[model samples]
Target: MKNSNLFKITLLFSAITLSISTANASKIDNDEFTSLQYLDKVTTDAFVEENKNKEFYDVIVGIEDDQLATALLTNDRMRKALEVGESFMYKGQEYVKTEHLLNVADQFRQDIKSMLGYDFHVVQTFNDIYQVLVTTDGSEEKEDVLKNLIQTGKFTYVQENEQMQLMGYDNEGDNKPMSVVNPSITNDRHYAEQVYFARQVDGYEGAASIEVAKQILSDRGVFASENKVNVHVLDGGMVPHEDLDYAEAVDFKYRNHQGKATDDGVIWVKKDFTREDDQYVSPAFDCSGFSSDPESENATSWRPDPPPEDEADEWYRYDTNKGLSLNSLHGLQAAGIIAAKSGNGVGISGIIPQENVNLVSALVVDKCSGGSADIMKAVYWSIDNLESPYAIGNSSYDGLPYERTQYPADVINMSFGGGNAMCFKRSNNYWTTAWTQVVQDADEKGTVLISSAGNETTTTFNVSPAGCENVMSVGAIYENGRPTGFTNFGDSIDVMAMGSKVWSTSGEVVDAGEFDVGYGPVNGTSFSGPIVAGLAGLLKLADDNLTPKQVVDLIKNGAKPLDVGFSGGETTCGWLGCGAGAVNFENSVRILLDGEILGEPKATHYLADHKQKDDSNYISLQSEFNPNLCSTYKVYGSVMNDKYEDLEYTLYGQVGSGDYEVVKVTNNSNFTFNKEHDNYQLSACNATTGNCSRNVNVELDSSYSPAACG
Candidate 1:
């Protein structure tokens, strides 16, 4: 098996060793927990013994759910620091160093599993945060646990789990099946419009695909009457506009770097104009807004000035393309594929044309072409203020290094990656480790981290976090559905999507003078990541009952297969980096509708009904009685006939409460319905009434009970 598969298998065993219980909980009578210190010493000694044996997986922890537990979870002062901006201070801190504590975390997770039964699976975990997953089982207990964790201070806050975050629901926000509608009759409005391959235009007026989006929705029976794709130019102001001929007008607002509400907002206009006339915005390509002159002696763009205008300059220009602007091109291409409207006589329609999705622009690279710590600050800003119902964060930019801190998002799309390898055999870099931790922690908190397999003229190493198993790394496929020439290939890559010749939104506005030129084609796996993100969002909207792994599995299973002749005729295994194949949107919907999306069925209903729940949102349940076969039990309750009324005592099995022939149920009340029995069936009698009948199948399966009549 390959490394990732091996790692996954190993992780399962590792989790099991963490839950080897040492002592019984009932022995500790007092809340003072006098046994804790002894337990702590025992735990420390166990870690030491395991260390001596070099048994890394054999170590375990002794747990006490007393004051120490509460202290670890809810220290008001530590909470305050975290609530403010002091999380960085605890950068390298570990809450519990004992091996037993780690074991306890894993054990508590297992308890949750036992209570919720099979549908809930544990996805990922970091030092403190644990992501437990749930599907359509939709039990009341799941909500109880989520809310209790918050109140008890186990977690600061619990948003919708990553798979269901911002997903579409019933009108009352209840989790239910989503209905598809024709886009033609839908509301035609967008929060922002993005133009890919942006070129210089005189003003913000430029031809875009927003019109295409509107038309697509219109064809689907959804009516888009207003401008849903809002377009704007942000330099230093909230530019306000009211009229839009082709697309939509955008109103800009400003906030501080930390995303605090601010009053500074403006509308970008021609250098010399004072009025808001659409035509007055200048269309020149001059870099004048900068404090430093573009033509100054020491100006810093991506490239050095057209040096000396000589043969040497030609060589320099060839070696380094001056202002080729691949980043801008890449970003714009992704935006277009997502929201460019159709029918304005330009561009293709996007996946979500109804304006149910919104795009936010936070500049990480300044005009001087320098990146600072400000890039991450912009990330935080986007998290704080972007108000779209669903936010798909796409970044074609990567490099530098980062600390392993929490990044909040329903989905984060990364198309740029290429840095260190994470293996014991390879020498590790701190920067790479930190960045990997970022991916790990984000995933733990229910964020789906999507990344691109970096492009290569030849071949370089795979990106670190993308190569990490938990991430959904993607690669690019050309229009012909083959792996693109420059696309990176790797085992860590989870899927492939259209990337080459892809179109997207431009950051420049119509008034910026490069409006018309902004719309065009670009290629790279970076663009592929967002396409997957958008699809991921749509899948989430369709069925909130999917776990992250199930979602990934669905995408892989739903992919359209390509001819695997390029690498070799090795059809089965060579496509690891390409992940099952290219994403197939239409087929995905079909599969979801076919009921393939329901989670793993419980082995027995006896395991399903027993639960323990707190006042919190997530519920927990314990088995009411010992599960034993051949034990007689008696269950008493009224029966409901096919007609909606109650009936007298019906012929069920014998009335022995704890013996081999009968089962006893204590939770049922006098008004409750007795649907449980060893042998019960429904029989339609004559034309007017139905009779209660018994069958042998009831002895084999509890579900073989009589059906209730209408």
Candidate 2:
């Protein structure tokens, strides 16, 4: 067996050593409450030992008085600083010892046990702030302990930890089967002819054969990488489905980064604000161990409880006939839509072809609802620690968790969101419900964050991340191009996509222990969010240098403009937050590849009446300039391109029973098209390479003929 294999075997045995007891409360030592001397320990080995044993108390204390830091360093109440000197990688981030707790003025003169009756030790110190480990026999309630700490004037605030939750529903009662629409899925009564959105486009639907990469890159010569671009997927356990690439699934929570011969895997670290134990495999590692399945070989081994206690979390209400294991179902569905193995002759294709979008599980959702602290850790780990930096990040979680950590990913997809669900129990109000500031910081880092407009049928302006500026919020539409009643729409949403009953890879829930591999259709903005994320991947692949702003512009500009009835027709300021309409994958790619000039060429008829062109109004052929009664007409073309890049433009005109003639070439201004023309087309070509853009026929209104605007 391999060295890593040996580590796993050792881990297997080590796991058996730790377990979670169902004892009602924190274990209390029946012995008399005795305190250990804080000043007696100046050595690091004993400090490491006590941390591993969980014999220390972890607490975060913010000193209101700046001088308290100096005073605390001299005061002999808490353990002295370990003063780590070197920088090392932990969960993917470099924690420089030089930056760790440098500004300490004094140590607490009063022993925590003597004054507050709680044992305390320093896990980490940053300047005046100290993240201390708190420990006791377990007789006192955590609430009461925190209360006592807050009562002391020495500390500005008490410490508390938070976590994040998966946005999709969580239930185990009965997972009914959902409908799946796939061309390859046959011999099933439940199967139906899938109406794919690709077929709705002009060139895509009419194409006879299915040719990928070539069809996508369009003779660009470079074959799109068969390997998918990896992104961070922070959610519950990762179930290795046939559609999923098992090799890419990672559990950062239990990843062993230390070299060979080192057993670094730990059972579980309490969600406390402390570094009590850095060693897990050693006897010094503080872990409840194998009690739950977080350390199991199978990632999904730790499933959610059949019925969660928090009924307010409506993750249980939604289900379908497609028998999906409620355990980690939502994350799988969203991930599948984004990167499920495509065109293998078994399942439907993803927006970004086959396995070209690799998903790295951040594993934030531990069980049911995730804690805020883990989410922040996952984000930091993904952005800083991943072996391969992710190009995109997907968060299909709704409701609130905790913390406001920055996620500087290239592209982030938030499929899950709610209007406003604040936790009254938590001290943080709306901040606990969403990572609003994090998204803003991500935007600053050039991370294009795309989010669903929510399925609540309300305005998205109030939804977090979505509501946050710089986030491309998307609403959902049906196969027929009509806005779904469930999608939240407003002036804030940037674009729309097909979200109703989309088909993708999923885990078939069975009575047996594990889920069988299969495919199905799921509804809601959750699935729609991936469609946009997948599009972002395609855009990035086309132009590796595309920025978040540029990608948003292309995706939004390429959208097939739609009008939502519920929001009262199009607004004068442009379509409300609902945006340009349904997203056109072909158009989006075309914009990226061809630089946006597959647009219809427009013609302005210079009638004998001396008509002129103006922005207030316009005219076109068939309505203003008829072949039978034609006058001089000025033809204009449009193409999006970098101003610095040398480009040439040509206007093509076809007269009645005549072939198209090049009316003009490389003309920056309007061309006087004085001819009895029937139709017109525009072409943009690379000035030096002689390569020309695809021909674009101008679209003209029937009621209004081509005429010059007054």
lDDT string for model 1 (323-424, tens) is 122122333444455545544434344554435444333323222122112222222222332111100121101111112223224555544443434311
lDDT of 2: 0.47
Residue-pair clashes per prediction, in order, are 95, 53
Candidate with top TM-score is: 2
In the range 375-476, model 2's lDDT, one tens digit per residue, is 433444444421211111211111111122233345656555534421111453212222443454455555667777777677777665466567788777
Over 4 Å off, model 2: 1-196, 201-214, 222-228, 252-326, 385-410, 418-437, 440-447, 509-513, 564-576, 598-639, 643-683, 686-710
Give per-residue lDDT, candidate 2, residue 530: 76
Candidate that would win on lDDT? 2
TM for candidate 1 is 0.39
lDDT of each: 0.34, 0.47
> Judged by lDDT against the true structure, how good is candidate 1?
0.34
Error of 1 at 295 (Å): 18
